[model samples]
Target chain A: MALSASTLKVGDTYEEQVVEDLKRTQLVQYAGASGDYNPVHTDEVFVTKVAGYPTVFAHGMLSMGMTGKMLTNYVGDGRLTQYGVRFTRQVWPGDSLTAKATVKAIRQEEGGHIVDLDVSTVNQDGVEVVSGYASARVDP
Target chain B: MMLEIDPKAKQGVQLGPVTVTAEDIQSFAEAMGDLNPLYTDVEAARAAGYPDVIAPPMFCMRMRGGRMLPEVPLPSGFMSLNAGQEIEFHDEIIAGQTYTITSRVADVYEKTGRSGPMEIIVRESTFTDAEGRTIVTIRERQIVRSPEKKI
Candidate 1:
């Protein structure tokens, strides 16, 4: 059954399972595949000394990817139409990151239903590291 | 050998006026395993208030994915890693629209840690539609680490 836009409402929150301890190796693999090998992500010393981070951190895109996965899974396949994000802070390794999306509004336009989502990522400290919005066409 | 880039020296160094097409967006969607309707379904998109099918938000990165050559003038080594990207959208990117990108080196800094020395480069990109209207602005940070440092 397709989930309709009307079924979703404002203040609806969804959370993704916390992956324990995002590793440096994962950052390396993302760097290898995505061509981002910035030292803050791969070099522990550089991350600590230069970036002033405690340890190497995860790539912003990697965190975005996880958030994207949550949306794709919740909205169901092919329902998401437009999505965008902004980086607010850096995500460090060993930090428990949670991706959350709240329905902001639902409107009828162009013969379909458009659902706008307020999406964000919060670390264990409850600080939002990334914030953005996504729009999707849901079954009316 | 560590390649050092003075961020101040390269400020506003435009890296792209790269043109992108609908086909490229489609190909990238496939590569990323994203099978969203908006990326592939025109009728569905039109019904959703879009004038036409649109690419995923992250699809903009593919514009820079045309394999860079070894002889290319990238500041670092032959290999370029995609450290990460940040995007802000002003409008949807539709099919058949020609887009141009302009990127500049934003910042460069060094850090030493348990592994070794690492160089960080921040690149800012502006993407404009065919009409010259800015569609999105992105800040991509790339970290180039010395290969000698092994965790």
Candidate 2:
């Protein structure tokens, strides 16, 4: 069901698990899909030797996309007006990721009921990888 | 502080006229660990009223050329990071469609942080159908800085 301002409370929380024991090929798949051939995300040797990273890591966009899934699954695809995030930390392989979306506020704006969200993605160790805000028009 | 790399008014810097295929859509959905039929199954999509299998919302990240921003010239010794992003979906990007993308440097500014100093570059990329209808607009922020000195 679509969440609306009437039904949405300020402190309501939503959570989704995006990945578990994340894989290396998933990054390859993401690289193939996104056309981001940045070696830091794909080549372990390049990352270790050239880029100085310990190993190949997940794209920040991957975490951001998984976080977006939490929103799309709840609000339905194509209903989000704005979704954004800040890349706070590197997401390495083997990290389990969970996206947390909390209702920050509800407002009636421009004749539409909008939901404000405090969104974040955290790894298994509870390290915040990405955090930011997202807003969407909700059903009433 | 003055920006090292100044911003410009770019009407549209063509990045892609890439085609989106069903495979492209499915691969991205799979990578995100999403099992949504609308992004994968044709029959389910048709039942859901989409003309064909649709793409996930963040599939826009997969659209080619959105990553071309960091190629811009910046101050030497600066390491760039994907700091933040703001995306607005104007139209549902469907599979098997061709869209062109263009991006421009919107702003550049410096901020002093705990790590010392950094430059933030802002960019706006637009995706449009061949007919030029709006598809999506992505505003991304990139942060650049020198490697932190180990004490």
Candidate 3:
């Protein structure tokens, strides 16, 4: 069900563990699905030797995708109008992530009511990995 | 400058008119670990008033075809990292429909942070369907960082 704007209010929050112990294989899967075969995300040897990173890391878009699951679940299917994020830090394998969305506003638009949300995803250590905003249509 | 880019980097490159498929939608949602039926089950999607299964909101990011960043030459020991992204969705990407993507280098600039000087390249990509209606627009930021810079 879509969130009802009648009861929605600013400062209301929802959170979910988007991923736990993020895996390299999942990165490979994302590469195949997204057609973003950047070696830095899936090739450990290249990322460590050539890219000079500790090991393969998750794609920023992957984190955004997972975080998006949380958003869609909160608002409802096909309700999002806009979703944007800044990749704050590198997400490494084995890092669990928790995504949270806090209601910023509930207002009326030309078509109907909408909810504005402040989105944030943080690693297990509480280091934020993705920060951004999303807007979605809501039920009146 | 930490890096050098081709003065005439290609922009507004038309990427694809690939048809969206149920397999593509399913794989993408699986990779992201989202089992939402609206993206996987056509019957469920139809119940929701969609013609077919719909791609997740961020699925438009995949339309880039591994061309998310400008093909600039990084200086020795410099690496590129994703800095941020902004996406606006005009409509849901429905399965069985063909879509084309056009990407352009919107801007390039330099900024110095606590670590050191870095260059940020902003790329904007638009996804449109067969009807020539816009589906989504994304602005992505990629940061070129020098080797000495520590995160």
> On residues B1-151, what C-alpha lDDT tens digit does candidate 3 reach at each position?
7355565555466777988888989999999999999899999999989999999987888767665645677777776777878999889999999999888777889998667788898888888989899989998888888666643
Give the poorly placed runs of model 2, Cα more than 4 Å off: B1-11, B64-66, B74-78, B146-151
Off by over 4 Å in 1: B1-151
Winner on lDDT between 1 and 3 is 3
DockQ of predicted candidate 1:
0.11
Pick the lDDT winner.
3
Q: Model 2: per-residue lDDT, tens digit, B1-151?
A: 2444433334446766887888889988888888788899989888878778888878887774436553566556445667779888877888777898877777778787655777777888888998999788899877776644210
- Provide the lowest-lDDT 10-residue window in model 1 chain B: B64-73
Q: What is each model's TM-score for chain A? A: 0.88, 0.97, 0.98
Q: Which candidate leads in DockQ? A: 3
Of 2 and 3, the candidate ranking higher by DockQ: 3
Candidates 1 and 3 compared: the better one by TM-score is 3
User: What TM-score does prediction 1 earn?
Assistant: 0.55
